[model samples]
Target: MSTSSPEHAIDRMEDRLARLPLRERKKLRTRRAIQDHALRLFAAQGYDETTVEQIAAAAEISPSTFFRYFPTKEDVVITDEYDPIMAEAIREQPAELPPIDALRAMLREILPQLFETDLDALKTRLRITAEVPALRGRTFEGMRATFTVLSEAFAERTGRAPDDPDVEAFSWAVLGVLQAALYRLLDGKTTYEDLPAQIDHNLRFLAQGCPL
Candidate 1:
């Protein structure tokens, strides 16, 4: 797979979550709608001008319910549910598998959920994230958080500190492949159908050997 970063991976996973049962899909869609509404207002009025109450009102969600879903106004844009699921998926992977291979497998395993989400919404989210500075930072922060999760998994597998450079670098490369594909998709240069193989081929080129 093309090397990918955590943001791109999360983006992909969020895409898959769209494939859940109608109830689940509806929940996620509503969540996405709230986020879209929040972002639209934030963009139109400026971050400082926006408030959770405004977002809640715009989303047609109760203020209390908005708090139930997100911690703060800024969180509506960044704190998506898919991040934890990705980490759990990684952790659930057989420990014997190399971390990079585990990530690839995890991506495959998670594909069903990806197919559940709306591609159009994903593209919109990507576009908004690209244009917004706060969103860009939060996206990278989300990536960094995933790196932390991956580091722990790698260390657990290899008996090294999670922060060890080799562990981190290896994790980084796996994410790099996904990011490459995402950049292409976000730019209208590639379609989701073409991404997996494109990412896999690029990843094979990078892996050289060692089984991934």
Candidate 2:
């Protein structure tokens, strides 16, 4: 089983917050509160039916505060607290490892963080993103941003430019594997504990040319 225990994940979050200035930490808390309330509202009602004012009221913040944290309703579903942390973890992988190997290592390291999340909320977010057209576009945009982050990490490790064909290709493949794993996991096709192993297995197949 993955070793990313809930306590450890919470600790990581707390530690991260500890390093931030007080104002920034407050901003993060407000953002998280807004997102949590928004997802709950989206799950209870249809995403299209849930207005920003309702979400803000539920979160005990004004609509203006919601706008300050999330530029639009779609951003609530598309953006996440984990992307930057994941990118940093990817960068922390041993320099001796190949780009794909580094990504594999990073994924393994972060799997337990998944346990720290509210699974139902995640499922709701995914469902909304999958079914809503606007959310779908925003999802793609978010994925593009993630690709850029991973590509830069790969490029830095390999002493290449972010747009270098090799760097871009490798980053896409890694992100693709991650996306596939997440889709399957969120579909309830696999046990939560098996998530990391599933990703690692698929990454291995990817490394092996995805043989038949």
User: For every candidate structure, what is the RMSD over all alpha carbons to the true structure, in angstroms?
Assistant: 7.4, 2.7
For model 1, how does the per-residue alpha-carbon lDDT over 53-140 read when each residue is reduced to its tens digit?
Answer: 8998998889998887676665676555465456667777888887667766776766544544434445556766666677777766
Record all residue pairs in model 2 with backbone atoms less than 3 Å apart, i.e. clashing.
4-112
- State candidate 2's TM-score: 0.83
Give the poorly placed runs of model 2, Cα more than 4 Å off.
3-5, 16-27, 185-193
- lDDT measured at residue 108 in model 1 versus the true structure, 0 to 100: 70
Residue 93 lDDT in model 2? 84
Q: Candidate 1: list runs displaced more than 4 Å.
A: 1-51, 58-75, 118-120, 209-212
Per-residue lDDT tens digits for candidate 2, residues 131-150, read 88787667667888789888
Indicate which candidate wins on TM-score.
2
- Kindly provide the TM-score of model 1 when superposed on the true structure, using C-alpha atoms: 0.64
Q: What is the lDDT of every predicted structure here?
A: 0.69, 0.79
Worst 10 residues of 1 by lDDT: 112-121
